[model samples]
Target: MEKREVVVSITDNGPGISEDIQSRIFDPFFTTKPIGKGTGLGMSISYQIVTEVHNGSIQCISQPNQGTTFNIKLPQKYNRVIPQ
Candidate 1:
């Protein structure tokens, strides 16, 4: 069967993420913000929803001082039931 997907791209011109931190951005409880300023669950939850619930993919592309981009691809049609 041919795979069909919808792509979403988000970009930011602000200072981009460093290579060291990029790999862990989607990890639960991982954040670079000050202790009281962030819960660190945003990205982790986003990753899970896209990959698990939607059966899709997400990727981050960044270069320090240049910019950052996030690309998400979701299947055009999904048949599986969401987890409880």
Candidate 2:
């Protein structure tokens, strides 16, 4: 069987996320924003979409004041061909 892989990355220049909380960023309702500012489901939903729906993987890399980056990898395989 032949398989293809796709990689994507997203980066931000704002105040980077801390190391202590980086692990829980994908958890449901986990946010560092002020009250009534965020719902905290964004990362959780994204994690589900990539890992569960697409059978892919997601990860985050960040430092206190440097920045943050999200790396995503997805499998690209087709079992049949379609006429174009």
Residue 31 of candidate 2: its Cα lDDT? 93
Candidate 2 at residue 27, lDDT? 96
lDDT of 2 by residue, 1-84 (tens): 667778999999978988889989999999999999999999999999999999999999999888999999999776566779
- Taking all chains together, each candidate's TM-score versus the true structure is 0.89, 0.83
Clashes of 1: 0
Candidate closest to the true structure, highest lDDT: 1
- Over 1-84, each residue of candidate 1 has an lDDT whose tens digit, in order, gives 889898999999989999999999999999999999999999999999999999999999999998999999999885565798
Residue 68, candidate 1: how far off, in angstroms? 0.4
Candidate 2's clash total is 0
Candidate 2's C-alpha lDDT? 0.92
